[model samples]
Target: MDPVTSGILVVIVLLVLMAIGTPIAFALGAVSLGALVLDQGMGELTFFGETFFGHVSSFGFVAIPMFILMGAAVASSPTGRDLYRSLDIWMGRLPGGLAISNIAACSIFAALSGSSPATSAAIGKLGIPEMRKRGYPDGVAAGCIAAGGTLGILIPPSVTMIVYGISTETSIGRLFIAGALPGLMLAGLFMVWTLLACKLAGGYNSPNPVAQAAAQIKENVEGNVKALIRVLPFLLVVLGILFALYGGVATPSEAAGVGAFLCLALAIVVYRMWQTKPIANIMRDALRESVMIMLIIATAEIFAFALSSLFITQTVAGAIADMEVNRWVLMGVINIFLLVAGFFLPPVAVIVMAAPILLPIIVAADFDPYWFAVILTINLEIGLITPPVGLNLFIIKGIAPDIALRDILVGSLPYALCMILGIVLLCFFPEIALWLPDLIMGTGS
Candidate 1:
């Protein structure tokens, strides 16, 4: 059979499996294996095993679990609660203060967690209730948390970036730095939109809920100084990761190791969480998440191997290169496709599946790889809040059972729009995502 025809069959089979609710890793692997059988006979099955193992064997892949462990440590301990409390104390008095603080807390937590659902769960648990109690609309509060949680992958130490960097052979450290500016920019945009929403609605303070929330705020204010003191170590962990990665002091993997250790130490020593069960639970949860992610990556590698062997990736890139359409127009079309795909696929699945085909075309278009990474990251950020399969949306729903899923989805729209706006800005300016990485590491590094 012709290679293109064979490639088409593989994609069709993959989709059929996915549509029936097969896990992404299994779908990818099964399709790749079937394709191998058609093209090279059953003897090629051994290659699949080797490919999967070799892909996961990378030293760089170590960062994923380490970052995950760090997040888990924070989650399983009191540190996460303290960080949220600190932000609530400091920012809760502003217009849409609770929601704004939710964004702030998400950004800080994203630095540690590197996973969207985790960020959403950590903040949504505390933020949604407090905002609702304070007379903030349920949709608005839930939406803010859902949208803010996307920062987990957009910010530095992002697991998605690590997967992108490793899969594409881009510099992981530079990718981490590239994300910092855009991540913070999007967070700011979310905050600005949130504040505007509050002001236009005559402030988030509902008459009855305001009185109720006022009392709660007053009670927390007396201990604000103490809360700030408790959150210092978490602040340092964020700073330390940035310094280690961008300052040329350590590679991303090494930085992840350090961050994970710091989180563990803080939980056990400072928080005095000496209980064995918490530690055990943290390890178990982190291991489960890490294994799931690694499996997706390994399967994606097998799929990419199959595509490369079929020359599908090169053929597709060549076809795009020959197209008469403007590169920017082509990029916009690709972004639209990714945005839609995000509704059905997780970020890792999207990155693994699409990056191989689209990345070559992007590089050939003279688009800076770093800038495109940010653009793609922002697209994934929007996907986190989109409906049907948005992980963040589901996370909020899970945490706030009383809130309607429609309300959560509705609330996330503005922040999603902000992310879309951020993408456009990056496309036109390109400098926003590059400046920090360039300043710290220079363009070549």
Candidate 2:
């Protein structure tokens, strides 16, 4: 088969496998194998071996598993729970306040983890039931958790940025810095819209039922604060490492390792949440998840590697470059297309499949990568709330299986609109993304 035809066939097979519910890793590997065989006969099987090994072999990839471990550790231990309860008390007075606070919590966790599904799975365990028991609307309850989960991509330490940096040969450190302002802006948008929506809905926030007692609210607040105080050491440990990395005192890989160890010690020794059984369980779970994510990453590498080799990516890039529309018009079209694509693709998968194509066009037009990354990240965030294959939505549903899918789906729309608004606001005033990167990289925009 001609290479172009083979690449096109590979794309078709991948979409079919994805549509038919093949796991993403297997779908990528399978499509790659099919393409290789058609193009180079059975001898090309060796290339699959090479590709698989090459994908997992990067030293930088170790950061992914470590970050995953740290996220899981915080979730299982008391630190994350304490943080949630504290935020809950502070925000529980307003309509949908607890829900909005949950969004805030996910945004905080997002800075550390950079994986949306992790943010949902972790925050849902603490946030969902608490909000429901407090009489929060079911759909509003579930929507907050799902929408908040998207923070993991927009925030600093984002795995999406790492992947983007790696793919584009940009500096990952700069990408991390680039994401800071935009992540917070998106989170702020979620909160503002959520506040308005709750007021308009009139049935959203759980009354300060406990808080009306004054004494009871005070007790809860004090207890949560004390618990959070105990968790501060761990938070500090993680922060210190990232801070050093950010200030150029250490590299990201070194910081990740340090952060991982600090989390382990805190989880086991300080939090006292670790028993032998739990420790074993944590390792097992972390390993299983890490392997699944790594497999997908590797397969994506193969697909990207081969696709670029065939210049199919270039063909797609050329098409986008040829369009002479206004940049705003082009951006709007790009964002709308991405939102539609996000409905079908996993966040990382969307990034992998689309960024390469869009990026060259963006660069040729002299648009900024950092700004584009933030913009695309926001688009992917909306996808998490989108229907059908909205992965975070389903993950939250899995946590609150008792909650109607309709409820979660219904609640997500307002938040989704808020996210879209954020994209538009950022599009017009890109300073939201550019400010921090400028300050850090010394490149005044």
Candidate 3:
């Protein structure tokens, strides 16, 4: 069978399985095993365990769970609420201030949690109700939280970046640093769109004067100060970990370990979560998410390996290289492919299966790998709110069941457009993603 034909068939089968609600890990594993068996006979099954194990048996992969733990620790606490309250107090006076505050809170919490759904859940729980209370439309309220949550993957300490780094043999620290500026840029875009949207909708403030007075009272100086005091330590811990990683003081895994411990400690001290249940809940949430991600990584590795063994990866890369198109044209095509892939698969799975195949082609085309990383991340971030498998959409629906999914979807579309705009801007000015990494690491090849 031709590699292209086989690849298409494999993808079709995988999609069918997923369409029928098969879990991603199982779908990947089953399809890969079938591909290998057909290509190399039943004997190929013997090496399956080793292939899967070897893919995940890396010191670098340890960072995923640790970063997840860090996020879990913070998500399991009241940190999201504190962070939201603090931002709302400061920014909520502006037109659509509440919506903007949710985006800002999501960015900060993204740094803390690094999981979109977790960020959405933590912030949305508080943000959605507050925004709705302030006369923000349900679609806008849910949309902002859902869109903001997507920031988790683009920000530093991102688990998806770690996965991309490990898969492509790129420096995790450089990848993390590479993400910082673009993450902020994307957040700023979300805020800008939100402000404009709110203004167009006659502002986000409630009409009731009594409610207005209560909002002002709630935003009092003392409460804002206390909120900041509670949220500051977690922010410091994230910054310190990034410093340690980029400064070469520690490896990604070491930085993550220390970061996780400190985040858990802060949750304990600030929230007084001395009891076993909250602590156990943190560990439990971390374990569940970590296991799911690890399984996807392991299975996706087998899938990638099978493609390589069957010459599918090389065939695809070679065909693209042979196209002899302009680098920018190639990038545009790649971005379209990535956008579609992301709409279906989670970022980790997409990176694991596609990055190895795409990285060489990207480098060959003279694109900066670090810059491409940010673009790829933002592409997947948009996927978190898109349809059929938009995880953040469901999370928003889960939190605010009264809000129509269409409203959430409608609300999130503009933010997705903002991400697309961010990508286009990055294309024109690659430095938005590259400058920080270059400054810290002294340039890249």
Which is the better candidate, 1 or 2, if ranked by TM-score?
Answer: 1
What is the TM-score (0 to 1) of candidate 2? 0.92
Q: Evaluated with lDDT, which candidate comes out highest?
A: 3
Estimate every model's Cα lDDT from 0 to 1: 0.83, 0.77, 0.91
- Any residue pairs clashing in model 1, and if so which? none
User: Model 2, which residues run further than 4 Å from truth?
Assistant: 1-8, 203-214, 309-311
lDDT of 1: 0.83
lDDT digits (tens) for residues 28-143 of candidate 2: 87877776666568987777788778757877777777777776666667666777877877787777888888988888777656678878888898888987797777877788
**lDDT (Cα, 0-100) at 333 in candidate 1:** 80
Q: Identify the leading candidate in terms of TM-score.
A: 3
Q: Give one digit per residue, the lDDT tens place, for model 1 in 22-65.
A: 98888888888877777788889877778989989999999999
lDDT of 2 at 431: 81
For model 3, residues 1-445, the per-residue Cα lDDT tens digits are 9899988999899999999999999999999999999899999988999999998999898999999999999999999988887787678678888888889999999999988999999999999998887688898899999999999998888999999999999998999989999999999999999889998888875333334577667556568689889999999999999999888899999999999999999999999999999999999999999999999999999999999998889998888888878999999989999999998999999999999889989999899998999999999988899988999999999999999999999999999999999999999999998888888798853
Question: What is the TM-score ranking, best to worst?
Answer: 3, 1, 2
Candidate 1 segments exceeding 4 Å error: 1-8, 206-219
